[model samples]
Target: MFSTSIRFSADCVDDHVWLGDLEAAENTFMLDKLNITHILTILDYKPVYNKDDKRIRLYIEAEDIGSYDLLSSFETCYHFIENAVQNNHNILIHCQAGISRSATIVAMYFMKKYTLTHEEAIEKLSNKRCYHMVCPNNGFQSQLQLYHQMNYAVDKTHELYKDFQSERLRTNYGLEKSDKITKTEKEIIDDTDRFPIKSEEKTLETEEVEYQCKTCQHKLFTRNDLFYHQQGRGKSDWSTKPLELDETICDKQVFTYYTDWMIDVFDSNVGDIHCISCQTKLGEYSLDGKKCECGHWVMPAFHFDQNQIERHNEMNHNHVEKS
Candidate 1:
């Protein structure tokens, strides 16, 4: 009842039948002449269409999955094979060459159903199916590596990638706010508890802390100093606001106080800054680095590292002024 056959030989077993090419004609002729009734077609990639026959069921296999998003596509094909196997349905699995992708899936089946290691299962499939089938480079190597490490490693390396992704996001520029604003259950509960107050309360209810105007040249850091500067009460180190502002006001006075708010909240210079544009860099940049002060799209935050902030400011100075 069991029989093995290679009805048609291909020029290069890189993938499934080149269905429309010259070789496809040869393969189709062979399939017709041989009366291939119960073929288990194994394809490494997409198969070429031959003469229309609803009777023949085909199974396709991809050589290498490029990324996590691709895993679902391969899993769907694998699930189809599983269902066919359960129903005792004859199938065909083909790749561009029948070497890597087809062989990998067969190997996976052996591992999943028979509890074989990747090496052992691959060896078994190559021996029984096609000895030439090998794990060649493309994207399959990374996929197989992921599979292998997940299968055998003491701690799953896949989880490590997940953790690394989280860390990358956490450390990326201007993402400190993003780190603080997460969607965890505990955080959700805390946010929910503060919902009504958050929604309604505009004025921040906080114990008065000494905070000087960040916009001014002198490094003042107290509320009393800030009040003194505002009132023009004592000898001010920095320039004082002009008492008269009927119509002779310059841009400096108007922009000074707003500048303080910007420095406190979104100053790229203050904190660690990643390129808010790319969200790829680590650490902080200047407050001017915030929003790229130029026209370039960027995020701003307090606590940005001085270097990045300065760099961003220098790079985008022209555009920042326009913005």
Candidate 2:
């Protein structure tokens, strides 16, 4: 078991990068003590920090789950770390805990950038940090393997393409008419001619039917939340379907729900919302309504974290899938 008391700060992976937990990321004192110049937070919620001219922060909206399609963010995160290192800044990569999501990303970075095999990259990370804690979950491991294999295939194809071009040039110039193409080269050329290599794009399909608590297997929201905005006028009144909450079912244990008047005066909600049955954190309740990035005003009743909740498909009600 991982103990927060044992280690809650950053672990240096190299001169440029460090892996840490939420506590270290949130605490300015810790960040300053470590001389961390840049921070990369991969979490569901936005990080709250004081603006400082000396420090830079990057937030990637991510969930700390095995099946959260973290690979989709891999390229973006890798480039960010690369830029930070090139600029001679020490960067801290963190999630809620530094055990899984963040660790997986660091390992993938090494694998992709350094051309290290998955095992080699993971071993290097473990040697630098806590070996016991630097473990990616099974789903993350599988995805990492897939990423490695895909890259390997692309690299090999490029190499073969180069060889094929050289052989064709030699034959065309009559330098070696008797020279024959190797079986592998012939196959590669044929395949390349038939189907060109394209970049892989990851797509996230939203599960709009039902959202359930990860801990208790309790249904939190149904299709009722999916609706068009009644007041908006821009393109469409279709508000982003946030998990609509009934005051009776969800308990305001994490954050208390304030009335409309109180929210306007305070400029923020008082507390987070939680599941009444298990007291699991569901989300926050914004009484005055929060503006989304897509230019729509949504009443933040319960913003469910895709990592913390399991989504149930509308077509298959019995099967539960991870978001």
Candidate 3:
């Protein structure tokens, strides 16, 4: 059934914020009765209603697909919502069916305003609109978890943003992952595998831990240059699925943020990773980043294949004090 029902937040007795579908949003009687001052529209296209009506509407273009990034749009919507909340004005966040897209925004807003976890926020929202069944898709759910991990602010350096950007660009350039775009791959052969490791790069940070080529056991990065993500900490990057899964389902990979030795690769924005010792092709990285089998992303990605390299124990490395 199409739910035109305009549901109020279960927690707020003042009835300042509301959730519903396009039908409810367009109803003049409801708006007049509730005194709605602002409408935050989350849809791929704009909507036109009565010609005589004039009300403030903020439109955000988005889709309901799990991979569709609504996390990036949260702050803008929240800012508009915050103004209304402070001024004691009514605001409605709505999408086509008032299911995934608008519901996700409202869920996130509640999470921020109340300092609640994703699960807690969803439970609270569902308490009010249980008939609507407010459940964000797995991707959106994962992003909400990430939002909590990041303390409710967008972390651009996070890998997921990189993956999202990569996916979006691929769509824009007609080259999403499904297209299997691999035009700039460097022709690396076993004979040409050995590249000279600069002495300056090697000795720069002796005290920090690093990853090593598992095969030859030679140090990969001079120090632990692992791009620390909030990933593998809370739940998992962009995944709300069961942790135990088939091997084919989750291909775990790692990424190192840009470092001094990688300045050349960053120039072109895409390149392959090779062991400095044996020159074996370990993995590949891109400024645009390769998305993981799980939905996580990283940008300026400097990830190495887990099969080719091993992480050096941080406990074994010494900390160097800067002079």
Candidate 4:
């Protein structure tokens, strides 16, 4: 139990930065002795402190499980830690076990300050402790790697972030099988994310262009709903070997980012998609995702046969918008 002191002799991983379990936080004696003026807690539940305490406290509710997205808290945590360090104030970061969640944040701070990849940050942190103390699970490890690609800031609009969120939601759905999940979990899973849909009747501004069923001209999707990918190059259009796509471009599939209609087919691993208006078999979708022939991978890939659907553009959105 945290009631017993588990505070290490030296939990400081960087200048004015310390890492440990809850003991480093709840033990008032340690806080006073170490001159800790700021506290950051990342766990499944919030911890309590004295009301009259002068120190600053930031609480982020995140489980330590592999699927939970600690990535979302990167920016907020970094800001809090940086502010304390700038003021020359000592701060302690802690989680339930201090193995995954707390360690991940400390690594993130080093990643920003030193411009290091997550692995390098972990190595630096380990050297500071004189042992191997940093170990985030596979899921968090993947998120940290992505954080490196994102340059240590959360870019919700980036293709990789979008893909990460989609996969996270899908994974949550699989793990959380009960009908009555928490409201937070429900909102997180049901959200349309970047599209910002209030209802299914109205479309989004981002997706002005549309794809229609060729046989009956039934309305399908806007360009915004589509998932654009890096085209592959092959000496010939149908060559088996993977390479960059050339001028002789032949795209055989159309992919969607997300749609309300897909909820039914995606209950399992794979499902077929038929046109809503004419009931014509347009294509198929897979929750497991598939790689395009052009050598790009799409997680939870929703693919429509190019021959079965016709493109209609309102804005001719050839270039993707980045915010």
Candidate 5:
């Protein structure tokens, strides 16, 4: 059975851009409801969709794995989205979960078109798409940083350009370098030169915050049961460790079910957690009290997944309302 947690609603990021998961993108009824005129699919393999003459479709074959070169498709996908939006056509971009691959593309689009930094673009997208989570993987994050440096750096002369020059030098000197400098290596060089290398240490900084169900505004987890936690030490950290749900948190607040993907991946009977009242997916919970790599035996709470719930902040709520 498909878990309700796997089901997601399309979120409008702007007047012309909508972000959603594969399920929402494939849902004909949802697409019609959103009046999406164009669809952009990013995946490792070819996407199979019902042929719809009325809706334009663009498929980008790229793996969601960190090693995949997503940068190659950035320019093409950006222009495709730009052209569609320029013509007043609403576009929906999707990947498997709309959390990584598709989110990275949309964030890059925002950076290129709006001249926003990586952080700014992510925040903007998150605020607009109040439901869906927008967490790009580490590889994508580094690439985006490089993209920002190349496109938005105040100093025209940066190490990225210097690295390109060095690569040319190595090639000219007949030095044995790889036939092609992979995108991942380039990003590493860019990062090493531009910023301090990050450490592997995981630190949990918790903030007591009230969270409410995104669908019905029902109070679910409060400061006692909910706390925002980041894994890494730096501002450029991409680790979005789930919110820690106290074991004492009311079990009645959520219902549990499992998806095939979860069962296959976790290799155990794991259930997707969702709000009991609105049936909105909160996150995945471990019935066996599994311990994460961080050595914390906290339940896996995906309250950070914007689709499930949001931190109860009056200012943020007002800002969302006004926007």
Candidate 6:
């Protein structure tokens, strides 16, 4: 006997209702095998809601549901799935063989769940579900694309602020300024400068170094000043390699070494951070130290194993040549 909550009455409309059948039994068995705890059926199409425990709830259509009609309010539907995932509910959403209506809901749900672009979520869902069905003239995909674009814009702005702060700190510490340091100071800061410093009476040269503008050849007072001149706020898209974290290090030092924003961009590759602009080599000086030659700021070059670094260099070299 089918419960009213999980059965359909044929006397009403087109006699579309479920009876004890092999296909229904097979579908139930498939759900069981997958360990699906619940199923929600929409439209007046009634199927047995045979589910494990009380975790599953089914809602039959109270009225005619159309492809163009919103299942729930657009905002409510988006938030409902988002909150369900946040609360750790493993929901397997379906509707009528997992195509059309169900696909629409699930497609939107995936976008909200994983914070993925509409195209990305749709592609993934299509791959997972052979149904791969999408409703034509659906605005959900376009709306989700707008969301992704907005997030990308915000991230870029935040990165710009962080880069500005790093430059300020470098300037304050005289790293980008004050080239009048003694030979001893020079040795302390950078040990690899091949040119020998000539100074009389142990006094460093107080004269400022002149830097010509790359674009206009305009004489600038300092290399640091020319840094501002060389800058025109162009975007730098560089490839990154991930590195292992030294968990033994103090948390404060680790935090200081890495920025909160960079941690996300750094994936599992090997430690190699190249300048997105000029492809010049980069290293971590301070939290504020990793500025590139193209005047774009970047995170420190994470040192991975030698083999890993070599692989990354090879990959980067290929990428640069391709571009």
Candidate with top lDDT is 4
lDDT of 4: 0.71
Local accuracy of candidate 4 as per-residue lDDT tens digits, 1-323: 22334455337898999987776677776777788899999988877666777889999888888878788889999999999999999999988767788888998999999999999998888778664366877788888999999978888767788677667766764422223435543343244332222222433335454678889987777644655454665454334655565433224456776565444333234677888677788888776667776655566677888778865545653534323
Against the hidden true structure, what lDDT does model 1 obtain? 0.35
In the predicted model 4, the residue pairs found to clash are: 232-244, 232-245, 233-243, 233-244, 233-245
Q: Model 3 RMSD to the real structure?
A: 15.0
- On TM-score, the candidate that comes out on top is 4
Looking at candidate 3, what is the lDDT of residue 124? Answer: 84
Query: What ranges in model 1 sit over 4 Å off?
Result: 1-6, 10-51, 55-70, 148-323
**Positional deviation of residue 313's Cα in model 6 after best superposition, in angstroms:** 81
TM-scores for the candidates: 0.37, 0.46, 0.51, 0.55, 0.47, 0.30
Better of 2 and 3 by lDDT: 3
lDDT of all predictions: 0.35, 0.58, 0.63, 0.71, 0.59, 0.36
Q: How many clashes (backbone N, Cα, C below 3 Å) per candidate?
A: 51, 4, 4, 5, 3, 1
* Candidate 2: segments with Cα more than 4 A from true spot: 1-8, 52-54, 152-323
Error of 1 at 157 (Å): 13
Model 3 misplacement above 4 A = 1-15, 163-323
Error of 6 at 137 (Å): 5.7
lDDT, residue 285, candidate 6: 33
Candidate 6: residue 6 Cα off by (Å): 22
Q: What lDDT tens digits, residue by residue, belong to model 3 across residues 154-263?
A: 76666655555555444433332222212221122111211222212322232334577888987766333444332222235434553433322122456554443332
Error of 5 at 171 (Å): 19
Higher-ranked by TM-score: 1 or 2 = 2
Candidate 6 per-residue C-alpha lDDT over 146-257 given as tens digits, one digit per residue, 9 for 90 to 100: 4455552223345443443334334433323333554543543243211112212221223233322233433222312111111213344333423222312111111112
Output the TM-score of candidate 1. Answer: 0.37
Tens-place lDDT per residue, model 1, 116-224, is 6777766666555452445634444444444555563323225643443233334443232211222442343333322111112222222222222222322222211
